[model samples]
Target: IELNAFVAYQREREAISDSAPARQLFNWCREAGLNARGLEHALLLRDRIGAVCRRLGLPWVEAEPAGNPEPVLRALTRGFFGQVSIFSSGLRG
Candidate 1:
């Protein structure tokens, strides 16, 4: 689910590279399932992408908070369960 959201955000941002907010939104999406170390890596990527977009004067789409954290949490939850499903399924006949 987290990957899905990332893919969706990537596609949306690709469609609109003239807005800074769009890039910011993508940054937020990338940080979704990250830990402290992971977040740092994500920040680096976000900063680099944002800088390039800004330098190029591109429009970026920003992500609006999904109103609540449930959706974002749910995506992470799905990703967790999905992984478990794959591993456990392999153990079954």
Candidate 2:
């Protein structure tokens, strides 16, 4: 299983608790002498898919801003706290 926690907002605001373990993992990797600074990436939907969705006349229905900040900060301050979001899209392939 892959455990990734982060803050995200799209159709609606989806805030994730800080998964500092992941951060620590990155730090650990660096300490372990692994060159992984540029190993992670992200694709903003609006930047990439928004135009297509709009041009295709798709019903881009989405909710307003909403997310859990308390948990997010808690996870960041701590190490093992955060939320998990599953990636179900095959779009990145």
Which candidate gets the maximum lDDT versus the true structure? 1
TM-score of 2: 0.24
What lDDT tens digits, residue by residue, belong to model 1 across residues 27-76? 65556643434444665787898999999999765545543456557767
Each model's total of backbone clashes: 13, 1
Q: Which consecutive 10 residues in model 2 have the weakest lDDT in total?
A: 5-14
lDDT of 2 at 23: 62
| The best candidate in terms of TM-score | 1
Assess the local accuracy of residue 3 in candidate 1 as a C-alpha lDDT between 0 and 100: 38
- Write candidate 2's Cα lDDT for 1-93 as tens digits: 111222211111123235554566465546645433333332343445667887888866432234435554564556543222123234444
Task: For model 1, state the Cα shift of residue 12 in Å.
Answer: 27
